[model samples]
Target: MRKIEFVSCHRLPERSFFFRGKQFPFCARCTGIYVGYAIFIPALWFIKIDIYWALLAILPTTIDGLTQAYFNRESNNFLRFTTGILAGYGLAGLSDFIAYWIVHFFKYLFVN
Candidate 1:
């Protein structure tokens, strides 16, 4: 089954944090991003953010990934995942912040 194959591919060492766990390769932050998005997007449906500002917050991680990909240096998976998680959280926080600002701005413009 596809699930079995996926699990087998990410088998970690016995000492690893995710040793024998279902979610391997992805650390706490990465897991947080995936789980957070599931929760946050619905929240954003009732609230919205400036898309550009959110993108700006996510830019650093994008740059890091692109640079790492294009360069010839061999980096380990851990560093890659760390950067990814940081970027994901940064984007999430930025989205939330922008959404909050937009809501406040609308409240001020309409109510005041």
Candidate 2:
């Protein structure tokens, strides 16, 4: 539980999902994000997505979270989960992009 909490706030019981009356370790949105990562990480090797498009994919989550945090707007679990998936995919793509460039940079610097 501590390790899970290290990665997620796990705050706000209402935002979490429960099974058999046991709460999930992470919130619904976080669960979706992790699920997205699981879906996309393996695909990164075959799918070459541009960082710009990946960043664009993250916009919906950013907007939704900001709106809810600042304006006190209510958000449903479905919306949160969907947006989290998008954000997670985008984040994975961004990480891939950065790692690719860094590796190339080092190869260029050392191999050339």
Candidate 3:
């Protein structure tokens, strides 16, 4: 952004966009990731999508990243953001899965 004071702003200027001559706080991918996680943190409580589904959600992000890294393919911000969102969902779901299993394991061990 114009402010250039924030850490993320400085770190990801190329990845960010300039609308109305104002730079975004983070790159498209980062924005999507943050937004997705923000959405997931709260909504995750209500939704019970399985870990396999979560892996499916994360697939796109991994593919995109791998292709870009190895093939040197160019990409747009919107796509980056989209992949980030998918990754974010996976990240949240995986975290929930781990936490859920851990709690259950302790409960089962201690209770029995």
lDDT against the true structure, each candidate = 0.56, 0.87, 0.82
For candidate 1, lDDT tens digit of each residue in 4-100? 3443233343312364544455443354445546655666667664656556646655765577569855444555455555565456767687777
Name the TM-score of candidate 1. Answer: 0.46
Q: Model 2 over residues 10-55: C-alpha lDDT tens digits?
A: 5578998888998878887888788889989899999977999899
Ranking by lDDT: 2, 3, 1
After the best TM-score superposition of candidate 1, give how far the Cα of residue 1 lies from its true spot, in angstroms: 9.0
- The sequence of per-residue lDDT tens digits that candidate 3 reaches over residues 1-112 is 2554555533466777778987776788777777788989688889976999889988988888789889998778889899888888888898899999999999999998
Q: Which consecutive 10 residues in model 2 have the weakest lDDT in total? A: 1-10
Positional deviation of residue 18's Cα in model 2 after best superposition, in angstroms: 1.1
Listed in order, each prediction's TM-score against the native is 0.46, 0.92, 0.81
Per-candidate total of colliding backbone pairs: 0, 0, 0
lDDT of 1: 0.56
Q: Say which prediction, candidate 1 or candidate 2, comes out ahead on TM-score.
A: 2
* Runs with alpha carbons beyond 4 Å of true place in candidate 2: 1-3
Q: Which ranges in model 3 have alpha carbons more than 4 Å from their true place?
A: 1-10, 19-22
Model 3 worst lDDT run, 10 consecutive residues: 1-10
Index of the highest-TM-score prediction: 2
